[model samples]
Target: MFVIGLTGGIGSGKSTAGEIFAELGVDVIDTDQIARLLTQSGGAAIPAICGLFGDAYITESGALDRQKMRQLIFSDSAHRQKLERLLHPLILDEVSSHVQRSLSQYVIVVVPLLLETGDYDHLIQRVLVIDCDEQLQVTRTMARSRLSAADVKAIMATQVDRQFRLTKADDIVRNNRDFGHLRAQIVRLHHFYLTLAE
Candidate 1:
């Protein structure tokens, strides 16, 4: 099936865009969601994570201690790489399973780090990037996640720069405006994708 790799920086409205595609009857597989599931209590990745990082990273409820892990990874790139090494393959396998089971004419795999990882290239026919200004990204992320501006900027620093991300997109949706504008672009793209699928 035709696949679109939907990606954008944090707070660039990727989840919103994915929801619009889903509302239009497209299959939307989100890798971040899959990752979350894997790291949650009794998740597939838990045993390995516990073994590798120890029980310190696992909360009393058996879920990942996201805040602690986030701090570690942000402070040390090596820790981030180590965690990615453990999780990326599992996420990819689950994503492939979802794609194969998808019933829609096309699929949108939302990977926030799509361009940075380059692992989903084989699965996507095109790239759809949600674009917004850096300030918007910082503000939106801070507002939604309750992360301080420094924390938001730190996450943004890990992602590919805006211009680089835009340059790689096969299609772009500028999401700095209101929901109506964002939805209008998504509606237009929805129809265009339908034609492409046919």
Candidate 2:
């Protein structure tokens, strides 16, 4: 199956774009969704995470303490890499299975760190980035996630910067405007992708 790696910085509307693609009959497998499943109580990654990061990183409810882990990883690159090492292979396996089973014309694998990870390079046939200005990313993220502006900025700091992300894109969707404009762009891309899938 043709797989487009859909990625963008936090609050860049990657999920919103994935929803639009789903509505248009495309199979959208999001890595973020997969990660959430892995971190849920009794999830597959729980044992490994607890072993590597210790019990304190695991909540009393037995799930990963996401906020705590996030803070830890942001300040400690080694922990971030260790966490990624534990999770990436599992996520990749799940994504591969989904792609093999998919019946759509194509699939979009929404991987927020597509560029950062580099492991999915051979898996994706194309790269599609949903982009907006950095300031707008902060505003949108803060509003949606209820995170402090400083918190949002910290997350943004870890992602590939805007210029680098745009440079790597096979296609870019500018999402700073209204919903109608966003939809219009998706519609155009839908046709383009359909033709490519042929």
User: Which candidate comes out best when scored by TM-score?
Assistant: 1
Q: Write candidate 2's Cα lDDT for 1-198 as tens digits.
A: 888999999999999999999999999999999999999999999999999999999999999999899989989989999999999999999999999999999999999999998989988999999999889999999999889999999889889989999999999999999888888999899899999998
Tens digits of per-residue lDDT for model 1, 63-149? 999999999999999999999999999999999999999999999999999999889989999999999988999899988999999
Task: Assess candidate 1 and give its lDDT.
Answer: 0.94
Which runs in model 2 stand beyond 4 Å of their true positions? none
lDDT of every predicted structure (CA atoms): 0.94, 0.94
Error of 2 at 189 (Å): 0.4
Off by over 4 Å in 1: none
Which residue pairs in candidate 2 have backbone atoms (N, alpha carbon, C) closer than 3 angstroms, thus clashing? none
